[model samples]
Target: MTYYVAREGSKLWKRVLGETKVELQLLGEKWKLLLVGVILQYIHGLAARGVHYLHRPGPILQDVGFILLPELGKERAYISETVFSFMFFSFVLWTFHPFIYQSKRFYTVLLWRRVLAFLVASQFLRIITFYSTQLPGPNYHCREGSKLARLPRPDNILEVLLLNFPRGVIYGCGDLIFSSHMIFTLVFVLTYQKYGSRRFIKQVAWLIAIIQSLLIIASRKHYTVDVVVAWYTVNLIVFFVDKKLPEMPDRSTGTSPPLLPISAKDKDSKSKEEQLKLLNGNSLDTSDRRPRTQVNGKHLEDSNPVNGDATMNGT
Candidate 1:
């Protein structure tokens, strides 16, 4: 029995592995591969920027503009950072969690496909935003001796610091063109639409993302118009991609229909079978048949008779 059980377990493992391999193969020609390369490039560019400026001198004047509006920079960073983190971690969990915990094979497939979709959407948006339009350089200056000065005041250190951190970090991170946060939030909300129980949580997450984006705009880390453009760009990309590549079918239920209350037709069919069984019980088994006999002044037949007595008979 132990050997049989071990053999069964091995077969199940092989089958699951086969399914995973097939799913991966199916994605080889899809947009997911291109998205993966895009993500790699994004990360590499961040690393390169960090190395390029690691030992540079203190922050420049335009850097000061970003530093003062930390809230703004933070809002921008929050959207991208949060979404990217969610997708990356989700994918990690899907791949490693199942192996460690023996989770349902189909659930793993669903998660993998979801992550792939997000990655594709994200990269596609990034490409669009990068090439959309260029912002003018920070060379414009205030008119000489004008009452309104362009540079931040010395006392605005707190504001500068706030803006500085997000801008410096984000610029350093190489994700300045597009909003990762918006893309991820939209994707997650759409993908998990079946989870009606978590609607509040989803709403809150969206609110947080939007609030962060607003802060980025208000603080001047990004122009209000730039944020608007980013938002629209993300939405447009998502819309087009969704139309072209509808989400992969969920595989967790083994192609079964969703669970629902039993139908009247099903119940009626079961009831008919039960009633027929009751009506035909006697004919169901030959062994249950009895030899011919009668009682209470009725004629009867017996296979054998004892002492010529009709009552004491055996068959």
Candidate 2:
């Protein structure tokens, strides 16, 4: 019993040490990601504030999606918020999945770095898009009865920066054109599709993402175009960004799998197999055709086949 305990304890220590070494080696990369992430988030926050201040109440534009789908009531709008919150928290929980799944290659920090990269690019485009034109706000907060219908002009830069925080986004207006909520949802879904192991969970993730989009549209939290644009834009951003990023290392091999075309390897293997088969066939044919002598009504073969010399025995 003691021996078993000691063996297990040693294994645990070794794993911990190995993980530590890998993390320490990546310390510089981790810090760089952290710094860039913080800066990008701050810039996005400021941009959101600027767009919100530029918002003006106007007639809602004619939208095909609105004509097709009925706008959900205020209660349903709250439900949409709830659903988004669930997705956000679920993604946060999933970020730490490497701990639960025991994957050396897929660390929580690495996942965050990848997610941050995708979001930063997405948000950067969003800022440029929303800044191009101010659209009429569509949510209940943008309507007359709501207290937050029209945002008061900012007195100073500090107020503008502060207003872009979480509380501000809750009742804020004019950061449309592409949905931030959809960006997060799609990023999480795509990341899970690539890295997560369970088939059921992957399907469930996609379902949740689809449902989340519907809820955003139904609740009128965003214009239909916002949701529609997000659907394709986020998907494309993830696809392209994933292509640029380094592939994750496999735990067993401690190296990333090659992303080269599979047909090349297959062709090489096939050629080798063909050559081996031909050599084998030729050897069989040569052995059968080799000369044999009959001595006293019995067949005898050469002692050495390599030289191909024939020897005869006579009575």
Candidate 3:
């Protein structure tokens, strides 16, 4: 039940050596599902990139949010990225922060599992919505004279997939029906709200999420609708996901059961049965042997006095 803290050295090494084996086993048990979640993320990225090739010159819609808010232009749009990076790393740190406390209930692995579920689901939906209709991207990269706005056709499908593997997402255009940024931002905040306890910190996280959303719009990184759609869609997806998935076991009191394979659990039950059988066998062996007594200088088995009395009365 001992939790490891931030300090690194022999103490941490020993702690990990003692505890991480079961945690790793627990994670390994669901590696296949986790791998699927990972693959879905990659596919989501590929879909987003593939759809980027379909960007075309089109009319920008009259967005009320955009109309009211001033654009920061391309030069200053990076501010949003800065704020987002802060929030992103803050969440990452917070996920690991519980390791330092005695009352830590959640583990980092479970947190990522939930994160993957929410992200993959939302990204899948985003892929469908974005590709359904090519909205003219509102980002600076989608503007005239921008290389990304008019990318040359790829020689083959492999080229499309391979070319986008590492850097294409940065320069890609037209995957903007719903803001991927907001999806991540909102998902992180909502997750923290559920798993974390600090009310003040949660309020600050929500504030940061809101600022990040507004920044995405004001910076022209995404249309107002994209951010707006992301707000509700991500929330709903997380809600449904939480409802569908089994609840994570709480480890705060160290009384929560550890995840075990069916075989292991079966073995435990079998051992208990064997122990019970042994107990029953010992009881039967003891019951079969009656006490012997010397009576009237002769050995005789002890008889129930009540049975002897009843027999005399009947005679």
Candidate 4:
């Protein structure tokens, strides 16, 4: 069966516009997709009577403050709840926006990859980790020697803010279960390597993920061991999937590139021109027919007279 899709003005527009829209849609879809996971986690927690089957080491310093200063204990709970609420709402918005609109075919692949990684694979891994490790609860055994322990002290306004409203609306038990960090970072790195040009941005983003994971561990939000395992697991899954999955062909070569309305002939012609321009180092100008000379002894003639010389010299 044939499918009808909207076309854009140019190949560049098609690739960029199509990809952008797809990304937005995929992002939105993730929130909705995660809703099921959220419900399941809550159900599981309720079934377990708010008792976690497995837990990682907690922050020793924070635990000490809780024991020594009861006031800090109250503050920590409040902060945790507040931060969690904020993170939850933000996640809802970030993950649900895509379901409101239809996405193009190119985006569908990306959307599926994310859904599989977070909604399926990551959750499975967490369950296995929980079962195998048989760790303590989310807040147990916090001591200086524990990998999950954090130095207990309000260092600055940031720590105080975190202490007061510990939980951001973005992350929660449900999110933790699936390790969104792993899913997102893996997808982002793979996607960037395959199609994106911003290598620096991708690298920076990966670094940020690593730092954030460390911070979470240091803060006693998650076990250092869990985070480490999650990093390797996610990277392995992404790498395998990326290797097995077929690379997307250059859509501009086909008759209908996504979001581009131009015919295949036009695309081919444009690409040919572009290739020629790159090779010759001269772009046709729309101004006077001045025979511009390149430093490398090449000559170019302007086709139209509206603008000026649009040629470049190799030298």
Candidate 5:
């Protein structure tokens, strides 16, 4: 008799991964880290090309249970194709936005390093799981609403290269356990919050992530479980990366200390003139540092309820 793993297996599996210690001493030293980061772009390009050439097509396992997602596969191959194409490029292009704009330099650099680590780890896991599960990928079938969805069938090496993975050169087999689309999507969501400005752009980035995830599932291109796994996997990656090394903060843009009512100690220790000076933008004590806001005349103290009389009257 054959045995299938219970749903409880998911928790058991995660527990094992959590207990596993991951150590990379290569990045332990500051000098080595600096050198690699300086040339990360070139390294990434080489790695992508390496992965592209290494992929070998083989027979993937198939099962009827999760062959096609009902919600996604409308069989209108055109819609599926269009959504896939759009998401593929959208994900790829967004990865470069942070570097191109150079908004939050440290966050961008940290994100790039973490992403590279995640990619290498994910690719390794995919290979192991592919053999272990022996599950056929959803890419092998395209069905939507009881109709056959027309889809591209790239048979040869050249065709596979031409129709590569959305974010990079990796190609999907019949049943990859996780979705690559979501990985890139979630990565952007993290980097953008730290680096991205303008509320409109941030909102649009989130919208695209939502649509891409749903689109992939609805089109029956990836199993529902695959999408879920991708979400969890990204979380795990983020956690591990941050646990080892905290996210690098940009020193040039130090946060301004918020204006607070003078403490009892401050009032006792300093003169009235010193207290007033501190309350305003200028530094009162020894430091030459100035407040974030440039005060031409009227100070930000006008907006504060700590104005003493203003708070007492409740005006």
Candidate 6:
């Protein structure tokens, strides 16, 4: 898949993406890794809900509601709670979009590991750092005379797990310190930038995120502080995840580390020497780069595993 590497500029995302004809493929298919990701998301959701309810049946904090973001507001967009639904609907769609499109397949094993790790860490952090505050919103007015007089009754982890569907999906008012929509937006936006695509597509991906976050404020689903904090938190996570989980290489190779950590050049000359030593049963130098060997010497002469048959020089 093509990935757009942004040029050096203030608006990095606006830089055009070009393909160098190098199609990167991971070592073999990672169907099982993708499957594990699906399962982990389910577990993460379960755990998030489990911990979310632990601090519930508590006091309401509507102090964050007074700071009006009227400029970003859409009049009556949430008149009957439609915008919130659309926000949620779009979020759900975006969650699975890359998977279906295959243009930016989230199928890489390294990517899957990073995503699962992010979910685990974020959820754990959210669970431990419970801030009992409510930012004013359409479905989240915790005042006494409001439709929802107080926050919903807290449910046990098992009960929440069993109750499922709409009930499980809904979040309470006090859990609005940070917005998941913001975090999710960053995830997809960075993913678009990483997977090699047009600059326009990348911009649109991030634009949607910004609009959604603004709408969250307009619709009163979150405070400005919520969105701000989420942006910072998710961005930090993105940096670490990218640094730790480097992209995988060609799919034909098995699941082994590359000879050079970040070097595209194979160090073929060096590998060739190692291959010859292995063939002759020489004790190798202490290095992690053990050369690839022919399985049974049943392959072609060109398949000498490194520099073809040229190394069998005087034979």
Best by lDDT: 3
Better of 1 and 6 by lDDT: 6
lDDT tens per residue, model 1, 1-315? 999999989977887686566545544544465566556545534432333222222222344324544443333445544544765465355454434333343344444454455556565556455445433321111122322213334365454434344444444322335544445555554444432235775566566557656555444434444456566665666566566754544444467543235669999998888778777543445575556544444434554434336445642
In model 1, the Cα lDDT at residue 107 comes to 41
Model 3 vs truth, CA RMSD: 6.8
Q: Using lDDT as the measure, name the better of candidate 1 and candidate 5.
A: 5
The runs of at least 3 residues in candidate 1 whose Cα sits more than 4 Å from the true structure, single-residue gaps closed, are 1-129, 136-177, 194-197, 218-220, 256-315
Backbone N/Cα/C clashes per model: 12, 0, 0, 31, 9, 5
Candidates 3 and 4 compared: the better one by TM-score is: 3
With a 3 Å backbone cut-off (N, CA, C), the pairs that clash in candidate 6 are: 2-196, 3-196, 4-196, 26-251, 137-220
Q: What TM-score would candidate 3 get against the native?
A: 0.78
* Residue 124 in candidate 4, Cα distance off native in Å: 1.6
Off by over 4 Å in 5: 1-110, 140-171, 251-315
Error of 5 at 104 (Å): 4.5
Name the weakest run of 10 consecutive residues (lDDT summed) in model 1: 137-146
lDDT of 2 by residue, 1-315 (tens): 999999988877777676565555555557788779879988887788777767887777887767777888886678877887888898898765444445544766677888899999999999999999878888878755566766677677777767646778687788888998999899888988887777998998899888888888778778889999999999999999999998666553557653333568899998888789786543334457655655555545764433333343221
Q: Which candidate achieves the best TM-score against the true structure? A: 3
**Predicted structure 4, TM vs. truth:** 0.41
Q: TM-score: which is higher, 1 or 6?
A: 6
Residues 118-174, model 3: lDDT tens digits:
999999899989989988877777876677786688878887767565668777788
Write candidate 5's Cα lDDT for 121-206 as tens digits: 55445444444553434453322221222224446655444444453333334334566667656665655655555688778767
Which pairs of residues have clashing backbones in candidate 5?
A: 61-136, 72-218, 72-219, 73-144, 74-144, 75-144, 136-174, 137-174, 137-175
Q: Which candidate would rank higher by TM-score, 1 or 2?
A: 2
Misplaced by over 4 Å in model 3 are 1-10, 98-101, 163-165, 261-315
What lDDT does the true structure give each of the candidates?
0.48, 0.77, 0.81, 0.46, 0.51, 0.53
